[model samples]
Each structure stands twice: as structure tokens, then as C-alpha cells.
Target: MSHPAAELIARSNRLGSDARNTNYAGGNTSAAGTETDPVTGQDVELLWVKGSGGDLGTLRQEGLAVLRLDRMRALVDVYPGVEREDEMVEAFDYCLHGKGGAAPSIDTAMHGLVDAAHVDHLHPDSGIALATAADGAALTRECFGDRVVWVPWRRPGFQLGLDIAEIKQQNPQAIGCVLGGHGITAWGATSAECEENSLMIIRTAEQFIAARTAELEAQGTHPFGPIRDEYAALPEAERRAKAAALAPVIRGLASTDAPQLGHFTDSEVVLDFLAREKLAPLAELGTSCPDHFLRTKVKPLVVDLPADAPVEEVVARLTELHQAYREDYAAYYERHATPDSPALRGADPAIVLVPGVGMFSFGRTKQTARVAGEFYINAINVMRGAEAISTYTPIEESEKFRIEYWALEEAKLQRMPRPKPLATRVALVTGGASGIGKATAERLAAEGACVVVADLDLGKAQAVAEELGGADVAIGVQTDVTSEAQVQEAIAAAALAFGGVDLVVNNAGLSLSKSLLETTVKDWDLQHEVMARGSFLVAREAARVMIAQGLGGDIIYISSKNSVFAGPNNIAYSATKADQAHQVRLLAAELGEHGIRVNGINPDGVVRGSGIFAGGWGAQRAKVYGVDESELGQYYAGRTLLKKEVLPEHVAAAVFALTGPDLVQTTGLHVPVDSGVAAAFLR
Candidate 1:
């Protein structure tokens, strides 16, 4: 016998994996099957419906809310009507089948009340286009004839489920229904039939939209009206540069309430939409789908500037538009909010659209931001099709406000896990593929910061980035710190990857253990170029972005004990270290006004996992001390006040400390990680 549970899982994955069938975590599926009762030792009818807060594409047995089918249907007896329908969600616990504790979703009532053995509820863009059309009821009749029925909009709850059940009974021949101002729902006697009916409805609607769009093109017309050249996308490189430059400003404004990470996309769909004449007016109407608006906010802030506008001009207008958007959001909350409503969430816009530039979406994490951008793209597709056929109409603003501020939604937000200390921050570490740089990247990533690993070797940097978490939380950039262009590119990469730079680790350097007589001009310049000049370039470029973001940042330098103490046969290296040490103080004094903190770490001998040491410097130092290469760490430790050998992780921990909250107010300072080199103490 075929297992209904296994069949249901396969069907859901098939539909949910495709973006056209449903959005991430936006739909639910259910299977009515027989489960062997744990206590009664008898077969019992059960409904395996998707649990709350789960993506259908990745649904598993643990994410299914198992309930007694008979008990779930019994909820109608005390539903208390649509006004008090939210109460039914709490009542679902009583319907759970023996320890079925996956937390039933609000749609549980819908799956149980329906007479079919299998059902699917999805928010496909094509189906929603017809549903949100002014003539959606007529459109449904035209598309599916009597096969699919049209049901008026009603929020999902016990009442809506009862309504759908009534519709199904009245229209015996109906295979599915077009939900007004929503999406679609389909049901069948088996999982296979139900999956077919769902796909059939989606495909018919898509064909209908495509045919209508073709008709418009035949008549020299467009759903979005004429395309504007001034709003067209710039060349890829130029647009990316613009996005990199403006992301920090938009992110800072978006972070008014809490820090936010950003994602930028200038895809063809986004560019084409921006070039349309209806871009402004249609955008002002806002998204119609609950899932889309929940992530994108009710509406986006449209930057009304030509694609090639000057950065200075764009910034001035963005500042004015951001403040206006906040005021508008505050008013919107006040207009519909009830005394019983949850407190106003942030008034900041989650999505910002710039003509000719692209879209910048903000969220507390990179994944959320990227998803928000995707949801808006879906909304755009829906609007285009709706306009091609009939006038596009969304749910009322008052209704949208109710859903946006629903108490249930507020509770979901409250249940979110606490973020890591550096969760919203982004850090860039130079020479991050090896040694102290790699250790710092790992440490910061562990603390929840998005890391940008920069090194001359792209492969090594990429490997370290992949180990850190790939593009979601970390990325690698091939950067030769000595070059001004590469330094600029690396900073731009950080801005593009994660909103802006919050912390910078200037750890790129080389060592040359040579006395004054042995040191040549070439030796001195190489050390100074990588350590002194390189640190300056990275710091200067990062500070520019930090100031642009207006979010205060940290810049750390990995200097050495030799920077202060007179260590023998280390003239070239010591001179460059001294230059880096002073740059920390100089940059601190200059950049303090912008809230940029600059600090340094002076370590004695980090032998293990030290790139400088492995590059022949360790043996040279060991020779100078008359000790074997393996005993150099011991030699360096015995000379210190405390006989403790320093390692790369020790330097990494110090980097965390200086950037973390404990020393937020301390800057222009150097922390010695040399175990205890009393002679290297700051005066």
C-alpha cells in the first residue's frame, strides 16, 4: 500500500520548490491519512498539515502538525464567528493527536474542514494577478469556466475554512477556487489529483496572462505604459559602483530603529520595472500579498532621480525622502492602530527603489534582506499582469494595517532568538587567508559578524570564506593591499556584500629580521609598503564608507612589541611597525569626530600559525637567540614577565576585545598581547 504521508511530502516539495507555485514559507499543504494510535492500538484518521513558520519546500516530518481529523473538524462547533476567529488557533492544541506538538498553523482549520483527502493553499503570482484584478470574479469564470469557483476575500481562520467548505458543497463540479485579493486553493480525493489540480490552475492563469500581454503588445501598448530612457539601468560596472556608493547611506537611514544588513540587485526584471512609466504610481499602491508586504513593508520608498544623477544630488534627495517616509509610516500606524494593537514596529522602510540604480532591501540579516527583494519582484510581476487585463486593486489599506499589526504577528516576532553580539555588523580582515588574519575571521564569524576575507591569493581567501559560511555571512576578495585601486575595490566589496563596514582589521604585513647594515633599500620599502602604506590605504577607504554610513566603526592594527622595544636585527620591520603604531593614534584623533575608533595590538612572538614566522622569520629570530627553531616561542616567553607563549588565536581574541562592547569607549590605545613584555608597555 502507498503511504499517504510519503506521497504528501513528495507533492509539497514538487510544488514548493518552484517559485511560481508559492513563495518561501507562504503556503501550506495537508494530507488526510490513517495513523496507528499510540495508546488505543487502532487506526485513527489524522491530518498531517504543515506546521507554523515552515517552508513547504524544506518541510519534514518534524515540521508537520499532526492532528486528529475528527477533532479538528469539531472546532466549527465553538468557532465564535469571524470576529473572534483568532481564538480557534489556540483551540487547535486540543485537536492534536497524542504529543503532536509541532505548533499548528492558523490554516489548520482550513485543511481539516475541507472534505477532500488532500489539499493545497498557495500564493502564486499568476493566480494572484487574476485574484486582485478589478474583474477577478469574471476573470475566474472566463479562465476556468465552472471548474474553478471564485470566493470573496476573508482572512484565513476557522470562518474562512467554513466558507470554503460551503462553496465546495454548492459548486460540486469546482476543482478549485480563485480567492479574491489573495491566491488560489485546490483539493482532490488523493494527493496526486490535488497536486495536478493545483498546477492546472496555476498554468491556466499564467497562459491567460501571457495571452493578454501578447494582445497588448500587438496593439502597441504595455501594462506599465511607456519606458523612460532616463530611468533605464546603467551599465553593469557603473551601476554596481553607484550601488556600492549609495548602499551605506540608504542602510544608515534604514537602520534608524535597529542595525540592518542590505542586499543589492539590479536584475533585468527590476531594471525593466524601474524603466516603466507606471513605476511611481504602481509602487505607491503597495504590495497586495501578505507575505510580500510582511517582508517588504506596505510600500517602498522610490528615489525620484535620473539613473545617472550625481552622488551629491542623490544623497540630498534621499535624506529628504527618508524623513518623509518615516513621517508617513508613523501616520499610517496612528490612522488604523487600535488601543489593543501591538506597539508600532520601526517606521523605517524595508525596501528602497532607485530609478536607474537598482533596489536596496534591508533586514537584520543578509538572508532576510535578499528574500525581501525577491518578494517585491514577485509583487511587480503580479501588478503587471493585473494591469494587462483589468484595473489592479489590492486589499484595503485598513485591512493591510490590521494584518501588518496583528497580535499573532507580534508574538511571532517576540519568539525570535536573540542575535549574537556582532550579528548586524560587518568586518573586513586583510591577509585573512592565513595566520592571525584567518583566526580573526573565524573568531568574528563565530560572534555572528559577516566577514570579508582579503588576501593577495584569491584561492586561499575563498577557501577561508567558504569555511566561514560562504556568501551568506562571509565572502573573499583578492586584494593586494599595497595597491590603492585594490584597496578601494575591497572596501566596495564589503559595502556590497553586507550593508557597510562596521569593523576593519589591518593585519596585512611582512617581516624582515635584518640589522641596519644588512637591510637594503628594497627590503625596507617592501616592509613599509605592505605594513605602513597598506594599513593607511585600508583605514582611509574604510573610514570613508563608515562616515558615509554615519554608523561609527572600529579600525584595528596588528603591530608588534618591536614597535616600542629595541629588538636586535629587526631594523626594517621595527621601523614599519612604528609607522603603523603612530597611524593608529593619528587616524584616531582625526576620525574620532565621525565615531571611528582606531586601536593597535603589539605582540612579542606569535610562533604557531604565524604567517610571518613560517616565512623564514622564525628561524632568523631563533638563530639570533641561539635557540632551535622549535624553542623560539619558549625563548620569547621566558624573557617576558610571564612565561606564556603567544599564538595566533591569542591575537584574534585581543582583536575581538578591542572591537567588542567592553572597550567601546577606549581608542587611540594599544593592547599588548605579548604575554607580558614589560619593556614594551605604553608610556
Candidate 2:
């Protein structure tokens, strides 16, 4: 058996080598991003794209061009057909080059043609193999079916774009298209999805090619002779060290995620392939799939020298290749692009596969890198199988352009709007020292609502405020929401600190474990004073502030699930919480005319390593359940569908959702943040 890591390393090598094969120097893979398309310009607030001559592996924000989205879409309807290509190309060139040295990719027209939020186009061994095969189109169609569309081989450039335009009109949902003798193109609502789709296609194709090749081997003598072992021929130390150096990079790229990373090349099949003079043809076919383009590009890097090449030297060569690749991308943009107005959706490849070294995926965030990495691993296996066949096929350049630039495809590119649901709104949360109150305070902070955390426990409140990250945005105030004087002082302080209050969360409460019959009147009075009466006092002050500010605000009450479902105990706590929930609905009804939104969160056991719960709740609950503290934790964990403890974060998320834009039309709703504890209550 072959180690998957070695196999991945070898296959990745082939993919990178293949990319360099097209223009041995490197290929252009960026977009001209200047000018001002009327449609894309109006639609998007900011469309950042990579600059020409910059490698995606080490790309930065400065390397990108920012553009509006709406302005570009408007051009699609007015501009159609082959003659428009030059105008489009010129438009891209004007904006991209006008900004000085930035260049666009050869595939700029394609990105301009798609409506995808993000797009990726690359030529890989699998794509090329399929493209060059006599039955490549049929094979791709048979394997991918409706998941992808196949285009007859055509020379890259303008006319191919027209063909893709026609095809995309027929299949609106086609993620990408395959060109008979070219590479692949994929698109999605976001870069993550696009990268995933590309890699998925490669994985699917690898399976198909492997199945077919195995059947052929059973029927006749294998075209490629028996496999051999080269890694075994090396010293044990060399093999171990190679595996050690390659694992993290491979793991990062996911070309092959073996248990120990060193297992990739342990397979006999992988060793034989790497030991070959030239990767011998196995059958007649293409590369893995179309999507591997963004990860592996169209080719792999090949080193004819010793296995122990200097790391620095190898890296330098890779760097030069990337630089040349950038130049090629720029030249391509110069020839094929017009106005650099629209944001380039799929011009540059996001990741690069270096044959002997490893794979590198570029992204601004870790998520972006991981998504690209996963695709590269899938591409490696698919490329191996494609090598056994003929060569990989790349999608026609024109078709790739259409998908990359389609308006509908680009619509998916918009990011989820930021969580500033209540812009310029101010909030004050009481009992914000720990648990639900603290959760609610943080939630409002995230929603772009300035918050003041008020609590009797000043230290805890201050700590929570500091963790929220901005002194300008949040503050900790000491006050008893139940005390009229203290409530007034806190409200006054908040007004001075953040101008005026726009939202108030009445979340202070006391929990008593006494049974209903055994409970003292003192317990009842204490609970009501803090939970129910305190809410009324705080709300009164908040309401006065709102009326004075002339901008009505929201009031959210953090109640308890015990208010709805009864246990044998918890009489006083239940009564007060019940009042809090009712108060929110009543307040919402009365405050509607003032433009205020009132809501409540009823949560249970918002456990965390905080002062309140860590004090005794865990221990007491454990004793009640006849289990140790750890066992009690496990009991709660098993009760939820997600099989996780109810953290303060979970409750905070609920509060955020309520205060967020998704609930603009919603008010007076009680969101249960108990991880299905309510469901359990119903059952």
C-alpha cells in the first residue's frame, strides 16, 4: 500500500508541473480592477480584487482593486456578443492599468460575464487530461452529469466566451463548465463555496477515473507497467525527515490529510509514479475535475534533480515561478481586458501547488486558507488518476469568462451584512455581572449598540465591559437596579458616558432553592425586589431617558424558564421571572407608539467558569442529581441535540439575534436560550 502523504506530494508535484507546462515561464492570473462599471459600481459598496503580478499564495489587501458591483451588472445587458469583448477588455485595461502597474488576468472577461459572488478558474492536470481525450466530453458528462456542463474544445479567448455565455443562459445553476482541451471554471456565492465546489469536482472526477482505470486494468495489460518503490530505496532518516517537513504544509493544504501526514507517499502506487522517468500514460482521459484550477492551477512543478534539494533554493525557484506567473497574468489582462471597472471575480488562482515542496493557499482569513487547502488535496488524487489516462483538460477560456462575470452568479458574492442592527442606539443592561445579563450586554455591544453594564457586583461588571474591547463602546457602572436612587444614578451616568440611552435590559434577579411550602416570605420579597421591582425602576428611568432623547429604545428582560415550567421548588424565583416576561410584552405594547422594541430571553443553566455559577450552582445541582459535578455537567451535555454544554455564548447569541436586523419586524418575543431545555420541558 502507498502512503497517502507521499502520493499527495507526488500528485501535487504533477499538478504544479502541469500548470508551468502551458507557458513554461508562468501564466497571467489577475484582473484589471479600475474604471467604473455603472452596474457593479452601484450594487456593491466595496469589491476588492488582486493586482496583476501578485502571487495568490502571498497576496495582500494592497494587491487587490476595490470596485462597486452594481455598475458592472448594468453593462451585461447592454453589452453582449463577440464585438463587446474588445470594449469590455478595453474597459478593464483602462481602469486596471490606469491605476499604474496593476494588471488583470487572461480570464477577466469570464469574471465580468458571471453573476457569482466569487469565482475561481484554473487549469489543472485532471482538467487538461479530460480536455485532450477523444472521449473527454462524454466522460465528463457521464461523470458529472448535470452538476457540471461540458464545452467542446475551443482555443481560449473571445469566441469561447460567447459559447459559455450561451451555455450559462441554458443552465442558470451551473457551478462551472469544462472545456474539452482546456481547464475548469467554478463559481459560488462566496469564495469559500467556490473553492469547495472546485475541489469537490476534483474528488468526484478522481473517483470516476480510478474506477474506469481499474476496470481497464482487469480487462487488459496496464498501459503503465507495474508500480515500483523509491521512498523505500532512500535512507530511513531521509524518508522520515521529508515526511516531517511536508506534513504541516500538506495538512494545511489538505492535498492529503494522512493520520501522521507522513503516510501520503507510503503507497506502492505513489512511489512508482514518483520514481518514473516521465509519468507514463495509464489510459486516455483528463485530469481530476474542473474545480482544482483555483488550488493547483493548470500544472505542477517538476524537479529533475536529487530528492534532497536545498529548501531555500527550491522555495526561491517557486517564488520566481509565482512572479513569472503574476507577469503572465498581467499580460493576459493587457490583451483580453477592457475597462477595469467591475470587481474581478475569478481572475487569479487562490492557491499554488509546488511539486516537490508542497501546496500553498492564499486568503485573508484562516477559513479562506482552509477551504482552498482542502481543494488542493482533492485535486492531487484526481490529477494522479488523470495522469494514468492521457492529460488533464482545461475549460475554454471564453466559457470560464462568462461564468466568472455572470450577474446572477455575482449576486451571491455579497457578504452577510454586518450586525449593526441598531446603529447609534445606546443600551444599559442591569445585573450585567454574570450569566444571562452579561450575555445580553455583550450581544448588544456586538450589534453596534453602545452598552453600559450595570451590576451590584462592580468588579464582575467591570471585567465583562473590558472584555467587550472598547471603552468608548461599553462601560461598567455600579448600581442596584432595585434602588430608586441607585437606578437614577446609573441612568444618569450612562447618559453622560454615551450621550443618551436607547435600550435597557432589565435582567437582575435572585434564585432561591427553597421549596414552595418551605419558602419564607422574606425570600419572596427579596426575589421580587431585585427581579420584578428592580426591572420596573430601571425601565422607568430608561423610559424617561428615551422620551427626553426623543428616540424611543428597546427594553429586553432576561427571565428564567422556571417561570413557564414549574419544579417542586423555585417558587419565589418563578414568580418574579413570570412577572418579567409579562412586563416585556406589556411594555412593548405601550412603547410601540414611541418607536421602542421590547423583548425577553428565558434561559436555563447558562453555565460557565464565571463567579456566579462557579460559586455553588454546579455543586448544588450535582448534589440534587445524586452525581458528582463532572457527572452533572455530562448530564446537561447529553440533553442537547448538539451534545454540548449551554455556554454564556449560546445565550449571548440569542440576545444578539433578537437585537439584530433579522428581528426588525419582531418584538415582544421570548427567545429560549436553553439549548432545547424548553423542548424537554414540553415533552
Candidate 3:
């Protein structure tokens, strides 16, 4: 019942959904067939190849660029040698069978040259491991015998297409070809045969790795070191803090002139790789294959964690290391670049490794950074597998340079859309698990800020992060604002997860309503600890990271209308909030010199979704006003001029306004979000 092209798309989607075969949109697929032209009523050969930037996992008919096979095949005669990449691209555009308007994959030529009706190409980790190993050709021969051809490395373009065609001519019986330091390609007369052949190659490579791993383990020869018990034994919170402490320093060093977001990974595999004794040498050897050159640099920057050192000392050492890294990278680029190569870009290392801590991946966006981290994690596994059998080998530096500087690859990077207003910025919100804090975090993320949801309840914080789009948009950190250690750790986590802290929302507070005579010393202490003292500790720590980054930032506090208008039996809550109001004024004056803006939002009667209104607090407050619990929301709404009950989202909008460009020049100001409280209006 499906169209012929639909079958090819379904087959492609199946292969792409498995990350072991491809990540994001890293693979390509094509189907060739004969279709009658509506205009001429003559049968014409057509090739449907995956379009540029199209994800195979979500591929549809429209996602494939339909090209005239006869026209594309004629390009081999037009450009016989390594033709200018731009010229070949122009030629491919001229061969479009229809006005699909989607750019074809750069591998279109290679697909056209294969003498088959269906073709599939993928960058499977298992295949890359075998292809990049020192004895890759011999291993290929051993695995598939004469059924597969082995092709040496060449930059992907017209020349690579010719090389593949020549291999096929020489070995007509081969089912597929293993590209050295690249990937695998399989072709057949039908989609089923193509899929089966691709799977066969992948399964064969997986079997080879498994058997090799077993043999090494039996001989007591291990490729990776034992995981660090010290790091593994600590609680998750402590482990996160320890690793986060180095985030800013590494991010600062890894940054180029262009801005980037830095992401940290402390997963089981990342930590184990970091703890390896030979980390520096192993990381410097290069990426597992040339395909990774676009995302991760040829080598990662290796540094010591300096766990016991003071923050200042760590910064100084990391600064020196960063300087040396840039110098070395520029030297390497100079040594290998050709005279006709495009100007160098992205000289900074994409990955940074710290022994006993974790690995940091950098990218233009959080998702890209996370993807780079995932790729490196795969690289670690493949490198281990290759080394378990023999020495881990990677492509030579010259080949790495060619791929990294390839014009077609550079075009992909240039095509990315401009960043959002708050792109690469980080925001940390206290008590971010619910109410105003949660709303503020969500808003910041919607505008492209990486948000840290800090709360006393770890589970609640994590749930909020997951709701806000997981680690790429939000990372939940369990932070007891009353404790100095937890406060410092939370800030460190934000800096490590992103590059640095650019926004801080001091919104973590609790309310206690009791007559002055009935208020216990314990209740008073708790109120001040979470409100006044807590705000001070969080603000100070956030200020430290912001100043270290030397970038101007904004800090907004969620104060209360009761700060100025006193209410009976609300001394504990009102007094603590008043203290925070004055503290904001003082902090504004002090932090302004460092280009940090300090402001406050005084919101009133925000009953809906308010934690203060939950757990019988609203009923208790209504009782004091001689009203039933059912009428509490209306009672508060009627007190305001707008006759509208202030919601948490309304307060979140005010926070955005103060931190956005509209208030770029405004500081030391308090914005009200109470729907017009006449008594609390600023004079």
C-alpha cells in the first residue's frame, strides 16, 4: 500500500533511530528508480537522496532531494579529478529532477556512482572502531573475507566518489566497502537487501569487538583503568559540586573570540575515562575517525582538576593552560594547512578532560554541546575496544586537517541560524521547584537561557528540570540556601553546566503568619534564615562567579508588598522581606561597579500555585479575615484596583522585563507586580 519512495524512507528511519548506527543526522540513504516524466511521457532515471540537515529518523518523501540519475552520473565525466567543491555543488544543483528546493547531501555523488537500486551509509561506532584501528584492512579481510572491499581514507567529494567507483569495479562481488577512518556503505538491488547488508556489516563489526574484548579480559589485559572510588562513593550532590568547581575555569580557557556554552558530563563512562592514568596521551591521539572532526576537534584539551586548590589559584593555573593551548593549536594549524585552504576558524578545543573530575564539551548551543559529549563518550568506548585488541589508532594529522577545513563542512557550520537574545546565558533560580521560582526558570529557558533549578527538595528540582526540557534547557541542583556550602555548590553547578552565571533570581523564601506574642524564636529564626540570610548567601556566591567571568549580569529578588505595608500577625514574614528590600539597595550600590544589575519584584496576593497558600495556609489566612476558604482567592482579587488575582506567571513576566534589554540601563529599582496595590505604590 505504500509508495516505492515511502518504503525507502521507512527503511532509512529504522536504521537512523538506533544511535549505535547514527546520531542526529549523521547518515545518508538513497533509492534509485525509473519514473515517467509527466511532460515528455518518457521514462527517466531518478535518484532520491537524503537532503542536507534532514534527520533520517524523521525522514519523509519531501526530505529527500530527487535528482536525475543520468544527469548526476554525467558529472564524473565533467569533473574527472578532485574538482573544486563549489563547482561540484553547482553541478549537483543543475541535476535536480524536480524543484524540491532542498539541498542534496554532499555524498550524493558517491551514491550515484554505486551500481545498485538502493544504498545506505552510516557512521556506526563499531564500524569506526574497526576502520580506525591500525590493522583495520587486515581486520576487515578477516571479518568479511572477500565479500567486502576496503577503501583508504579520502576527503568526501568528487574524488572520494571516483575512488569508491573504482573499488566497486575491481571487486564486483563485494557486498559493501569499509572506508578507512570513515564509515561503511552497502548497496543492493532492493531496499531489503541494502538494509540487510548494512546490518550484516554492523553485526560483524560488533562480533569482532566482543570477541576481542573477551580475549583481552581473559588474559587480564584491560584498556581502561578502574573507576575512581572516591568520586563514585560520594553522594550525587557532592560529586556534582566537586566536578562543577572547575567549570568556569575550563570554560574560560576553552572559549574562543566567539561565545560558546560549556557543558559538563560526569556519567559513569566519562568519569571512568577521566580517571585513566594515561588520559593526557590517549586524548591527544585524536578523535576515533575523521567524521567527528566537525563536532570535536582533532584532540581534547587535558588539564589537572586542582581539587584542593583555592578558587583563585585554580583560575590562575587554568588561565596559563588556556594560553598555551591556543598557542599550540595555532601552531598545529599552521603546520598542516594548505595554501588554498579556507581561513582557519575554531582553533579552541571542543572537549576538555580533567582527571578525577569529568569531561567538559563546548558548542554554540546546549544541544550541540551535549551531542559532542555523547560522541566523545562513544569515542571512548571505541578507542577502548580498538586498544583491547591492539594499539588505538586514529587518522593522521594531515587527513584531519583536510576534513576539518573542508569547504562543504564549513558551509554546514555557517548555515546555523543566528542565536537567540539570551543564547549562551545561564540563570540560577532558588526554590525553583514550584510557584514563582519555577515559572521564572521556565521563562528564562524559553528565551534561550540555560537554567539551574535550585531547591531544598532534590526530587522536586529534578522533576522541574525534566519538565523544562531536561539537561539542555534546565539542570536541577538540590540547594539548601541556608547552608553556605550548598549555596556555593549550586552556583558552581550552574557555571559548570553553562559557561557562567549571567542571571540570578533570589526567590527562595517561606512565610510564617503568627501574632508577635505567639511567634516562637524558632519560627523567627527560620524566617530570617531562609529569607534574609539565604538571599545574602546566594547573591554573594552568584556575584563571585559573575565577576570571575568579567561579564555584566543581572540579579533580581522576589520581595513582597508587605515589605512596606505591615500586616497584623505577619511580623516574621514581613520583617524578613523588608530586610531583603534594604539588602537589595545596598547590594545594588556595591555590585554596580562590577557591571552587575540588582533589582527586585514586589508581588502581592499571588495565591494561585503559591506554596504559601497550600497546606491550609490559605484557609488559616482567610479565617483571620472572617472569610471562608472557598472565597479566599476572590477576597484577595477584590482588594486590588484591577480586581485580578496576581498569578506566578505575571511575576515571571516582570522578572523578564527587568533583565531584558528594555531595562538594560535600569538598576537599583523595584518593579511591582501586584495589580495596583495603592497602599504599597512607590512614592
Q: What's the lDDT for all of these models?
A: 0.91, 0.56, 0.81
RMSD of 2: 22.1
Q: For residues 1-683, could you state the per-residue lDDT of candidate 2 as single tens digits?
A: 44322222232233334432221212222222234446455322323444443444444445444433344434555555654454554455443322433344434545545555555555544555555555677777887888778888654445565566677778887877776655676666644466566666656665666676787688763434443333123454454344334333322222211111111232333444444434323211212333444333333333233446655464455445545555554554455444632454333334443333233343322233434444444444444544456444334443444444433233434533443565556678887878767777777777666678999988888898888764656779999877998997787666544445667877776666667786899979988998899998998888866654445567878786776867546678788888998898898888888777888887766556434456665666566557777676577777666667777667767777776667777788888766667453522
Model with the higher TM-score, candidate 1 or 3 = 1
- Candidate 1 accuracy as lDDT: 0.91
lDDT of 1 by residue, 180-290 (tens): 888899999999899999999999999999999999999999999988999999999999999999999999999998899998888998999998999999999998888
Error of 3 at 602 (Å): 1.7
TM-score of 3: 0.87
Clashing residue pairs in candidate 3, if any? none
* Predicted structure 3: clash tally: 0
Q: Which regions in candidate 2 have their CA more than 4 angstroms from the true location? A: 1-419, 639-643, 678-683
Best by the TM-score measure: 1
Residues 1-683 of candidate 3: C-alpha lDDT, one tens digit per residue: 45557778999999989887766677789888888988799999888889887778889878888899898988877784565755687689889986854688778888888888888888888888777888889988988998888898777777777788788778988888888878888888889999999999988988888898888778875676444443332346755665566676566556655567888887877777776655667788878565576787888877655334455675676677777878888888899887877787867778887655577899878888877887888788778867765577888888788778877777877887877767877899999998999999888888788899999989999999999999888999999999999998788878777867889999998877788998999989999999999999999998887776666789999998988877778889899999999888999999999899999999986777777777566876887788987788788788889988888999999988998767888888998888888998977
Go through the candidates in order and give the C-alpha RMSD of each one to the true structure.
1.6, 22.1, 3.8
* Superposed Cα deviation of residue 384, candidate 3 (Å): 3.3
TM-score of decoy 2: 0.39
